[model samples]
Target: MLNLFKKKEKFILPVSGDCIPMEKVNDPVFSQKMMGDGFAIIPSDKTIYSPFSGEVSVLFPTKHAIGIKSDAGVEVLIHVGIDTVSLKGEGFESFVQQGDKIAQGDKLIDVDFDLIKQKGFDPVVVIIFTNNSIKIEEKLHHGEHHEKLSISIK
Candidate 1:
């Protein structure tokens, strides 16, 4: 009966761009949902925002990816560009450190997609739920606004 009280959370798009099905991504790891089922956005802007209020769980030294764990125990991985690790922090600047508390819309990282592209990488911002158990209650592609996706943690 207590299930009714479960906190409902909404995820805003980390960047402003096109939302495509995970299957459509070029990388197999993300396309197969190997890390976890989530979504991807081809960012038109350089700044990446926090999708939800959470603690920064893991921030890669290379600054290619970040993991944020929501209070509800949802772990979200935000990876910028495919095969970006090889860049070794180049063209990427992180605004938040690991373990930092972040709110929705907080600036997390600034990525230079042009540099990534020049380095022969696809700058597709991939957001994945590392924890497979969390169910994505809904995916609302509200055109060009703060509200884009929603996830309910049970």
Candidate 2:
């Protein structure tokens, strides 16, 4: 009966990388969860995937970031590095457009790591739920790609 009442949904990691606690990100905005509660990844691959099945809500003009609205009503923002917007999308390639339907694990973007570093940027992909009305369960101190984390609606 208790399980039947559980409102939590599993959100997967969009990249194939080592998940780190948000504080490790070095940016106050992300480490502070000011954008929303979520995790950061020290990505091993150049690609980015969708963490949930949802609609692509926003794709920044610079192509350095993207946002999605999950079918379950969660709003997610995936920002691809610290201050990387200054690069003006130089090393990034977005695979999806705004208003497109996406599924978890769908490839969303591809990044040029060397260019980012050559340009002196720390490429830390952050996954944040912009709306705080929901509760994010687990510290998510670390995890593997596509690992499940629960989010409960309040």
lDDT of each: 0.80, 0.79
**Over the stretch 1-154, how does candidate 2's per-residue lDDT look in tens digits?**
0010143445667776777777778899889878877778888899998877889999999999999997777788999988999999899998899999998889999999888988889988988878744455556555555355555655
Off by over 4 Å in 1: 1-6, 133-147, 150-154
lDDT of 2 at 86: 94
Candidate 1 colliding pairs: none
Best model per lDDT: 1
Model 1 TM-score relative to the real fold: 0.85
Best by TM-score: 1
Candidate 2's C-alpha runs over 4 A off are 1-8, 133-153
lDDT of model 2, residue 45: 91
| Per-residue alpha-carbon lDDT of candidate 1 for residues 1-154, written as tens digits (9 for 90 to 100) | 0021255555677788877667778999999998887777778899998877889999999999999987667678999999999999999999999999999889999999999999899998888878744444444252333334445444
Candidate 2 weakest ten by summed lDDT: 1-10
